[model samples]
Target chain A: MNRETAFNLVLAAVLLAAPVIAFAANEPFYVALATRIAILALAAAGLNLALGFGGLVSFGHAAFFGIGGYVAGIFASHAMYSEPLPFGLPATDQMPVIWLVAALLCALAALPIGAISLRTTGVYFIMITLAFAQMIYYFAISWPAYGGEDGLSIPVRNSFVGLNTANALHFFLICYAVLMAALALTWRIRDSRFGMALQAARQNEVRLAAVGIRPFRIRLTAFVLSAVLTGLAGALFADLNRFASPSMMSWHMSGELIVLVILGGTGRLFGPVAGAILYVLLEYALGGMTERWQLFLGLILLGVVLFARGGVVGLVAGKARYD
Target chain B: MTEPVIEIHNLAKSFGGLRATDDVSLTLRRGEIHALIGPNGAGKSTLIHQICGTLMPDSGSIRLLGQDITTLDAAARAQLGLGRTFQISSLAPDFSVLRNVMLAVQGRQRSSFRFFGNVMADRSLTDPAMKALSQVGLETRAAIPASELSHGERRQLEIAIALALGSKALLLDEPMAGMGKDGSRALTDLLDVLRRDTPILLVEHDMDAVFALADRISVLVYGRIVASGSVAEIRENPEVRAAYLGARP
Candidate 1:
């Protein structure tokens, strides 16, 4: 294997091992932290597909993330109270069913948002996306059905037929498996024909059109797919915390997702994982020391942007083959 | 007479107050290089844009192989075998020379939706891409990124892309802009070979290359075609000499 692939494999092993060791050492809290990294890494991996490979700067991914969380929250709430949904569908406490619904709903939400936002490029694209996410964020806060600004809580952990998800170690393993699947999916897409067209669109839209590939179509697909993955992560995130809140859909959450992707690496496959690990660790380490930890985080971000353009992955694996 | 591969009739475009293209009409026949020559701001690029579907003509009709394609987008027109190179050398800078050509080959095949199969290992894509690169004498530089190539090489790479697209009609806008003497000569020879199957609408300033290769020449000035004829006829036209070729010609 090449250096990058080797580094990625080592990263995957470490992520898996850290959680297992935590479980063995009776540090379920540490296991929860590892789970948070996996879920955030999965969410950032979704964004990386569009941001890094397709060059879409979507500042609205929190919409999808929140949508996923609400899907889990709304369903689990209905299951807990034994109430049919507003649409008259039976509520499901099943994680797989929740994930599927989350993916579908996120895709539905992303289609219109991406279609509108993609019409404008660069700063306009960023603003429109941020605007759409804020729209959803406000909608969730005002809609009191799922507790609104107060959020909804899961009294019991959602079921995963084969395992007791209430167990921290089991839940971490599930999140870890999902993260691996997402990373593999990202790798496959980077090598696929669709991926080629997406990257081509990123590099030169005119050249892509000259070759007969519609940049709009390619980007929309990536955006939608990205939403589905992030949406899935959102469901898992809500389950991990046993709560779904407007905070999940907040603009700050959106910024954090972007931050995670950048901290890891923009286009590198394992970039988000590294970024998530560093971000969570920093939040844990620095947040304990001072309430103003973000100040330090900002300074480190500046360092990465100015000196380490490739982010942590670039530092570890060297420059990407093509740069 | 060769059949016309592309027909642009009564094409006109105005950028606010400026009349960029005024009633420009041209035909690119099968098996010929139809060269478009003009001075600066003479609307040559604008005309190319309209034909390629990037710029919509205020009033015009474009046909590819007798089918009206006036309403299609640039990508649709390309899919219908309308290939073009930009004046500014547009390329996927991070993609390798082979991958750049492979994109065109894949575009022609229209299988960009395949998400699982590895395109690099797919011989169907690499074979045609490699063939086109070899045709343009760039097979040796296949692995190099487009960004790293010299100016002349980028032009060659563009031609390779057009070839890989299997274009029935080709639009080459200043294809030899940065080409050296030998590079231009090699390109002239390549274009001569390419025209045997795909007709070309060439917009160039290199008069020697134009004179050496054009089956027909159209000279534009102030957004109008002042003269259109054979090399000998255009060289002798008094209006063309006075307006463009200058007093010495």
Candidate 2:
């Protein structure tokens, strides 16, 4: 196989195997570390659908990610207290139910945000999306119903069907599976007709209109779908940390998600995975060396932007054939 | 006569102080190539924009298939069977030739919202796109990225995309702008055949291609139609000669 293919395969293998090896060595912290990478990568993958494929540079994806986290946090808290959710739905600390709720909430929130943000383009679009996210962020911080700025903590790990999700290895496998499934979905979208129209809209909206595709609708749909996926990641992340707070919706989280996508490769299927792995590794490696690790990270990001036009995937795999 | 495929009446547009499209009226009938020719900055492109719904006119109306489309946006007008090509080639440069045309085909299909199916393996979209590509003689190059195509090939790809849209009428803005002698001649021959199935409102500056293919010619000067008639009539019109053709020779 070619270098890119080989690199991609090895990367996937290492991500899956490293966690297993760490669990066997009785270092459960490394397993959690791997799970963190998968969750973050999943979030970035969602943003890539809109930013990379749809040419929509959203600066507010953290809104969806945070919403997802809150969904898990709120549900688990209500269950722990033996209280029913509003509208008479009983709270349950079940992973599938939490994921569904998170996905649904994110979809509902994304619809209006996408509809409004899509009416503008360029800087206006970026600012509008960021404005929406910031609105949510401030709301979360001020609202005291669920710990507000302090955040809510889950008493225990949520349960999955026929499995003890509390086990680090078990939870890592779940996150890894979800990440793989999301990667498969990304591959499907990149090669599909809808994907083609989305990519076309990014390249030239005028041309897309001339051929009779409404760019606004295509982008909005992509935006919502991206939010749904990111929201799912957020739910998983809340479970991983056993806590959720306003920090999840911060603009920095959104910026970091965008960075991960760019660091991997803008439009490649595995770009988010590669980017997340490297970012977490660097954060861990560099943070241990010095408290001013961000300076080094910034320098490295500048280097990638200047020298490697395609991010890590571009450096390892070469220019994307499809893009 | 049966209604023209597209009818524009007294269409006027202005930019600040200048009237880019001044009371322009034109029609494209079935089985005909109506060429709109003018010197540079005569507002040929502006008038096309108004017809295709990119730019709204200050006054007047555009009707397609006898439906008032004056207020429709570009995508709405396109959905009503209006197809267009830009003066500068406008294709998804990063896409393969086949994929570029496939997008147009998908646009015309019901519900391009299908997200799960494998579009690459779907025959319904690919088949029609390939057929359109073949019609424009670019079928063999379908695998190549559109940006990789030569200038002449890119022009052909634009037409192929237009055709894939199942456009009842086409707005071709300077299709021959950058073509060589042989390339222009080949396109002229293609238009001759394409006109039978879909009428074209061609805006071009290439005199040879215009004289060779126009079933009717309209000369625009400062956004006004100076003279319009059959080839022989246009050649004899003194105003048309003075405004445009006189400067050519």
Candidate 3:
């Protein structure tokens, strides 16, 4: 690994592990907060693959996030009450199974979305991806099943391979493990052969073609992989809250995903996670300081975009030059 | 001893009412450096575009090793061993010189679907890529990011990337468009060695480099071939003199 990328990953791991290290045996609230950070980070991490690595600014990741959330909500509710699944596999509150279904569903949805969106680049790509998200958003709103706009309620969180997913601290540990694994996986791809091509296409597509590599196929594959990972996070998120709603898939959720990447750092593997931690904490801290914290949050985010070219990692790592 | 490696016959293309290429035909046998020289807007870039699959012709055919590829897209034609170099140095600025070439090598080998693992971990992609860079005398700079390379080095790296793709025929568009005398001479020397292994269709504006490196020459003017022959024959052709060489200062 390049020194910069390796250093950035190391720094992100420390930051992500900080909360757990400080409060490993903490109060339930602390565990919940750490859990929230990992889940949100996972969603943003998926977005990072497309937005940071591939240069595809997808404003529809919330669809994957919400789709993942609904998988948990829908499955947990049925399994708790012994209702059959659409596929007749018997509803599962198992996190692994829920993650699988959500990934497959999100990837399948992203295939057509990517096919259409990849046709256009720049402003057209941005607008088309946003439009696809809005379509899904409206579908969730119009559908009356599972509470329509109100959302679905998970009676209990999903189970895991062990009983560790039951306790708050244990559940937080599972999410943290998954988050770390995802971070490693993402870091590996960034340095991989395909990753080189993806980054190259982002830099100079015409040049890539002269080298005999087609940019279109390369980017489309990255886009799908991004959707799958982001979708997995969505399932975990629904279980954490015991809820699934249109709010999870709204344009705001998409915006929040981008915000997380920008808040931490773009292109850095830990950027989204750092952004997630800082964002949730900011919301929590500022929410306590004042009721109208959103106004201050907007100002802070604006300050970041205007003054901080790199995100939190950039600030911490002294302007990392990672590929 | 053999049919030409590349042949374009009666290739015609027009945008609206203006003919960009009018019945342009050429042949490049194996191991020959064929130079195409023309003034600005003489349809030289257009011809390169058609050959590289960036633009489609209105009619006629292109054959690589006697296999027709008139309608194939850029990537398909590339798969058939047609490599290209652009006028603008197109490369991944953030990637290392070696990784840039490795992506091309990866394209020629297996598909790029080796997701989840680091491609850097795969020696399969980098070994040949390094060999290609070494051939261009850029192996020492392999670790540096492509963005840090000098313009001349980037031009050399661009050719290395094409070499890693294992192309048998090369379509070079103005390798000396912005180079100095020294840089141009270096490129010409490199081209001389490359021509031994690859059939090159050279589109350039440097008269000295063109005259020195080309085994044969074709002069295009106003979307038409005014004259084509040996370098000495082109210099003496009255039609080429009237249409281009003598028309300008």
Candidate 2 regions off by >4 Å? A1-6, B247-249
| Model 3 misplacement above 4 A | A1-26, A164-166, A318-323, B247-249
Q: lDDT tens digits, residues B137-203, model 1? A: 9999999889999999999999999989999899999988878999999999999999998899999
> Candidate 3, residues B41-138: lDDT per residue as tens digits?
88998888888898998998999999998888887788788988879888888778888888888778746666656666668887998999999899
Q: What are the Cα lDDT values of the candidates? A: 0.93, 0.91, 0.85
Highest lDDT model number: 1
lDDT of 2 by residue, A31-115 (tens): 9999999999999999999998898999999999999999999999899888999798999999989999999999999999999
Query: Model 2 compared with the native: what TM-score?
Result: 0.97
Q: Output per-candidate TM-scores for chain A, rounded to 2 decimals.
A: 0.99, 0.98, 0.93
Candidates 1 and 3, the one with greater lDDT: 1
Better of 2 and 3 by lDDT: 2
Query: Each model's interface RMSD (Å)?
Result: 1.6, 1.7, 2.1
Q: CAPRI verdict on model 3?
A: medium
Please tell me which model should have the higher lDDT, number 1 or number 2. 1
Better of 1 and 3 by DockQ: 1
TM-score of each: 0.99, 0.97, 0.95
Query: Model 1, range A1-323, lDDT digits (tens) per residue?
Result: 88888988888999999989989999999999999999999999999999989999889899899999999888898998889887899987999999999999999999999999999999999999999999999999999978988999988878898999999999999999999999999999999999999999999999999989899999999999999999999999999999999999988999999999999999999999999999999999999999999999999999999999899999998877652
- What is the CAPRI rating of model 2's predicted complex? medium
